[model samples]
Target: MKDLFSSYRIKELELKNRIVMPPMCQYSVEAKDGIPNSWHQHHYVSRAIGGTGLVIVEMTDVEPDGRITDHDLGLWSDDQIDAFSKIVKEVHRYGAKIGIQIAHAGRKAQDAETPVAPSAIAFDETFKTPRALETEEVKGIVDKFRASVRRAVQAGFDAIELHGAHGYLIHQFLSPITNRRDDEYGKDLTKFGVEVIQAAKSEMPASMPLIMRISAREYVEGGYGLEESIAFSKVFKEAGVDMFHVSSGGEGPIGAAGRPGTHASYQTPLAREIKKALDIPVIAVGRLDDPILANSIIGNEEADLVAVGRGMLRNPYWALEASQALNKKVAVPVQYERGFRH
Candidate 1:
């Protein structure tokens, strides 16, 4: 039987355990230039030292206007690359694989003169109603995503995950309610998502894995459902996506139904369904705090990986503690050895 601590390899990267520090926005970057500072470096380095198998960096905007918050990290230029490279090296020293989630906020971009999306839809009260993107402008966003992937590879990240989920740029395109364009982009729901994957792949090293974070269900009327999400997964697989990071909600009409409440393994069923439909590995996320529940998801073939966000934020050594509870040995940094022994 495979244990949670069992090593798993995807392409050239090998995870030390099944634990993944799922991307969580820190909102802790330089506002003007969106460069990662010392705070970002130390935060991720600690997680690496805490024995996380894969430390996925927060959602990094591919362009200035793509930022969801004023303090989001970005990789739109050469200067930003140097700043992020420092943290990548530090995380690598702790023996963990690093991945960057490159994204565009689209209509969800906050505090911008004119946020761009497939249509002119506002995400919420906090965000401004976005300007519908022109066809030429849409092409520019694709180029930016490709460029960002190149920068991430140059910064020495082991892999890059395209931030397609969570009501971001790709989600804006995927949801019918948000994407009302009559052109090529909206006519084919899967077209834009597949293009981003291809563009990112083109800029990255051939051996490096590319994961697509997807909102498996919109959980609202006239929005993407499980059937459409499953069909979309096929397009992603054909586009060379190595894994599917399954998440739900965040892209729907105001006050939609079926939004999963905060509960243990709340989103595991989405992962299970997607995994059943696709051959690629499925990563389950959302309120996955308990080791028993995580073990059950993996043990029952529900998901190949479990991503813990708030849980890990509250406890950097959550993976280590969970491993101990499961009677498995995990690497502990020398500095934390005393606490681990106790």
Candidate 2:
């Protein structure tokens, strides 16, 4: 049976194991210029060395104004490409593949003087009431995504993930609760997201699969449920999304309907649903900190890969630890093998 220690392949990207390090914002981009620094290199390279099969860098914005915060990374400029390439090179040296999640924070862009969204809705009262994008501006954003992907390719990343979840720009457009546009974008909710996928795919090589992170369910009242997400996911799959990083509930503040809830494997069922509905590979994430549960998800065919977020933050060697915990004889760096004595 294929377990967490088993290899996973999608297109030309081959993971050493079914373990993935999902994008979690470090908010460590010290340079306001949006370029990654030594901190990013250390952060990612350490995970690679620690045995993460695929380390996905955090939410990297395609434009300065698209950042969730001023400290987030950006791929809008060529100057930033080489810095990312350096990290990719080091990660590869550890026999791990790496990806970047290109995204736009939209109305959630805390640092923008005035953020933009599909509609004029603010995420909440504390957030700015964003200006709605004109038809042309929406198209421009698509171009920006394409440009970012091209830059990622130049940086020699093994894979690319489009950030379309968490009530961000793409999710805002995808969710009916957030998007209330009256034009083409609104009429066709998936249009903007599909365009972004197509744009990203245009810049990616045939071997480089494009993964998309999506909120499989929104938790707030009137927010989308599993049915809605599945419908859109089918569209995304057809639009060339090679994999879905299944997550849930970032649409807005949790309402009386309650939140997605915090518990181990809470979102694994969501990933399973999408995988079954679309017949596509998926990476299950969310509180999957237990190596046993994470491995079971893969072993049972619940998800193709499992992303360990908080677990990884707490222990960079989570993957190596998992291998030991599962009693699987996997490769460990010679330097660290001595430390894993049975």
lDDT of each: 0.85, 0.92
Write down the lDDT that model 1 would get: 0.85
Model 2 has an lDDT value of 0.92
Tens-digit lDDT string for candidate 2 (156-267): 9999999988889999999888899999999999999999999999999999999999988887779888898999999999999999999887786422123534667878
- Please give the lDDT score at residue 52 for candidate 1: 88
- The RMSD of every model to the true structure, in order and in angstroms, is 2.0, 1.8
Residues 1-70, model 1: lDDT tens digits:
6656778888888888888999888998765688999889988998888788899999999998899878
Best by TM-score: 2
- List clashing residue pairs in candidate 1: none
Off by over 4 Å in 2: 253-260
